[model samples]
Target: MRVLMRVAAGVLILLLIAAVGFFALAWKGEIEPVAAVDRAQFDQELIEQGARLAAVGNCIACHTVPGQPAFAGGLALPTPFGTIYSTNITPDPETGIGKWSEEAFQRAMREGVDREGNHLYPAFPYDHYTRVTDEDNRALYAFLMTRQPVNSTAPENELPFPYNMRMILAGWKLLFFEEGAYHPDTAQSEEWNRGAYLAEGLGHCGACHSPRNRFGAIDPERHFGGGEAEGWQAYAINTESPAPIPWDQESLAFYLRQGWHEHHGVSRGPMAEVTGNLGLLPDSDIAAIATYVASVMGEPDAERQARAEALLAEVSQSQSPALVDAAPAAAAQPGSAQGDGAAIYAGACAGCHDGSRPQPFGGLPFSLSTAVNAPNPQNIVNVVLYGLPPADGEATSVMPAFGGVLNDEQVADLLAYMRERFSDAPAWENLVELVARTRSGEHKVAIRPSDGIERGPENVGASGGAED
Candidate 1:
């Protein structure tokens, strides 16, 4: 009995010691004071600078709910666990960042901690924000501060049990978050460095472009080779991508500035929103991003290269004979002979889709275009239905929504015309089916190709039609 009593006593002492040690560590981890800033000294130039940074970061895209004031957050971002609503960052005393000091803002941006010292979820992208330069951070703060404050409170995040507990985020941060500003590469040019900083840091491109590990944290080693977000497969941005079209700096800039590029392709899915927002940024910044992305094109591994090459080869070899036969049938139709497609194309699409015309406004020629020529018809269908805006930085182009103007048949006709005139690819009867499936609520704004049934090589020419 005495020995048992001594064992219990030892266990109690150990527990007490552990409890004390944990408390001590928690106390030491308490957040420190924020650095001071003189808001009174802030000027118009700084405010404009802030606005530019905000554009680069695409802050409004995630923060502003439809019908809500800009930056007055209420956007629900769906994650693997549940939906997390964005917080209002406007300077409203009751509901926004009005109470936050510069230091608190910096802490949240750099360390993934909130003003209350609670660890912020990685959904906020603080892991990438940690790389933003202090100067840019200050500018962004200034811009956000000057915005009109709306007194709307965002809804609480509906995360799973232990994840719901904000304190547990501290452990998540310990595992994933890194502290500090961007370290400029001395060997790289200033433009490249600037682009790198923006893409990896404030822009948080990695949040969407980089692959994630099992824990839902980004796989840093993979960088921006591509990944999935909110069920949408954000296509690989790397140079070795299996995409039918390869991206170059000029094409990248055109895509960034205008949303669509000749031979490369148009931005669709979640990227359309990104391009719409990026359309507001300056041209130089867009060019810088393009330059940086172009520089990093050779990073894909051997397996990826082999797979991409095989897919390309298969696509090339499998050009449909039936599609080639159907071209004459389309051209022989009396209405088509009278240029029915031409009138519709000219009237509805001419403003933005003139192919290879050397004009900034119209789309480059669909004839022989890689996007048009690709075996998969999803890209063309998506562009026509949703339309695309130019990139935010220099050379902005806006793609008007044709959802109202064109019917499913008209869209099909246009696609058929483009395919017939440009490439030997087959006509897509599945396009109407694809459109209906995409229009269904199953997909969010972005069309997830994987969400739908995939047609196999045999089905490609067989009776397997697209699902409506």
Candidate 2:
């Protein structure tokens, strides 16, 4: 018994010593932060480039809270540990990074430390940001410093116990963080390489799109397979899409550029914000990102894709043909009474989404829609429950939310009906529960598409129209 106790004590002491050493080395990183007085001067060009880089980083998305000054940073990000509010990143000296030196800012990005030499939470995504070039970091600093300074102070993080200990993040970083700049693939083209850099580095698409392990590290093998963010599904840009149509370069570029592609469907939830930021990027940059992602995602089975597309086309033509007026055609298989799936679609959804209206107002042929054909019908449910809002603050045509009007079973029936008619994919299970969960705000957009072919027309992009 004494020996066992002695051995346990020794192990505890060893762990204590190791923890102390880890903290010392993590904080004593090679970076020598520059003095505040030695910060770089902000050039106009640098500011503009910084703005572009910021867009690439999607800085404003997480930093700015709704109805708040941009970059004043009060958005609360929910993690498994607890909620962490985004810090003020505007040029305010007290609450923001206004007083930070270039090296301090660089250290924060590269080493995950703050101006005060404290470990920053990985929620800031310094893990991926570490790969950003020094030049780009400087530009980001310039852009940030030039922004309108706000004095808003974010609420403190609400983490529990040891997880709340900022010191623990050092170990997390040690375990997972790999600091460096992106190295382009020599075998790939310049465009492809640039896209790779953007996707892997500044864009940090995988951070949100890739599923995380229990340690809160992204599962590398499932990169771009789709993940959750801010209560929305970051759809897979990989081959694992539930999208009926395979995404190619042209389709992706169109979706990213317009936020609404005819066949792919409109961006909503978090993706709308992403597409909005992508709009600020150069066309070539957009094209490059599309090129790389499409290549990596590769194509789905060609034969499966063809059959689904054909099925979708036939369904659309037969069930919801172009209307002579604003009226929908008779239902193929009417339900005996109210709440029948086809009847519900015709009465509630078909007028706007039957592909019977003019450009920008009509819906995609159900066969070509990414939403209906998605592996999970949550996107369809999202549209049905919350309705599609004006994207990017632009008052494009809008769809009314059905949360107040439709019951859970009704929504489920409508969705199942859509899958049955528009897609040859297997009908989703637990739809009633899915709708209820979505209504209660417990559901997220699907990251992984269920096994099936996502068939659709090529280049069928973010088309102008309201689709359910």
Candidate 3:
């Protein structure tokens, strides 16, 4: 027994030493780089393409905070581990990527290493960026390098021990990261391939739409099965979708490009940022993405799709108009604190979401609303708490923020009513707790919840259809 114990101790010591040595060597990356492009020479075409690519990646969305110069990164993205502040991508020599050469930039994107050879956290989404085409990478570099330099330092990362051991990421890359470029599928159509590349490579759509494992790495098996972002659930765009009017390429293209569609609805939460950024792309690029996503999330058969639309049109999106007009009845239990959900909707939501109303606000119907039928009721709760930020620049939204107005119980009541009336799905349990957590900012949300993005009062949400 004594001899066995000694052997085990020796093995453990050896393993620890090996791990320490391995980390020391691996942390200082030794990978070779491809030939560096001549950074001094770039043209308008590269700059233009880079701009388009950046829009697709929504690079500025994570890097910039409200009131900050674009790409002067300071936003704190909350993750399970800790807050990871985005780094400055501007051309500032002291604080931004200005000092990085083309070789260093490409290595950072391709191998998840920084200019000084330190491993970059995956929070930067270099995993997807690794698959970006070299041509696109060149363009992105050209575009980013030309940006006006902003002299600002992002806050230091606030990660805990072990997690903050940046060298440990070497193993994480070994386990989860793959180095490669987008490989076009020969069997698929050119349009389909283009869309796939955009969605999987540049768009990095899965970052939000796909759930992560305990390690904070995306579960590859889930693919487009819905995931959480900025505390809001990014709805599944696959067969798992519970949308009343099944999504097709046409409707999706309209939604992606315009930020709203008659069959669907206006984008909100993190999706709003995505849709807004996508608006910068050409119509053809948007259409290609829609096509690829539609293929993945094949629409309901023609019959069911048509029938669902017809039902929505006939119903004018009223699940229970009579309920809305009725007086509030006593709680099902005498002492229960639950309020009348229908009455609340009548006072708050009906003026716009009710189909009988006029253009943008009037046209959006609730009975067939996707949020009402979601597997989890988080989407509805999110919209109610945060409210759709008035999108004056794109699809102008009229929805008001109830986060300050309604208590948790009220939001729960409203959510229950929406689910019961619009969808046949089971009632969401523990909604009050959920609302409380969301309001208190305990939820790991990826959205920048605000009242409006326009040059006006922060709390003033638009209330009418947009002119542009």
Writing each residue's lDDT as its tens digit, candidate 3 over 1-468 gives 343343444444434553764564455644443333344677988898999999999999899987789999999888766789999998777888877777777888787888878888999988888988778888898999888889999998997655576766766676678889989999899999999999998799898888876566788898888887767888888887778888889989878876666667667777877887887799999999999999999858877777796866666534366643442332233333334676676667765665644433443566667888888888877778876655544455456678988889888887887677667679889999999988887765544432123322223334444322
Instruction: Enumerate residue pairs that collide in model 3.
Output: 229-446, 230-445, 230-446, 230-447, 231-445
List the candidates ranked by TM-score, beginning with the highest: 3, 2, 1
lDDT of 1 by residue, 385-454 (tens): 7655433232322355576787776777777766666565576567667666555644445431210111
**Model with the higher TM-score, candidate 1 or 2:** 2
Query: Which parts of model 1 have CA positions greater than 4 angstroms off?
Result: 1-41, 299-439, 446-468
Q: Regarding TM-score, does 2 or 3 come out ahead?
A: 3
lDDT of 1: 0.64
Report lDDT (CA) for all predictions: 0.64, 0.72, 0.75
Model 3 misplacement above 4 A: 1-40, 301-307, 317-339, 392-397, 444-463, 466-468
Ranking under lDDT, best-scoring first?
3, 2, 1
State which candidate has the highest TM-score: 3
lDDT of 2 by residue, 179-266 (tens): 7888878999999998988878888989888987665778888988887776666677787876766778998998777666666566
Question: Residue 140 of candidate 3: its Cα lDDT?
Answer: 90
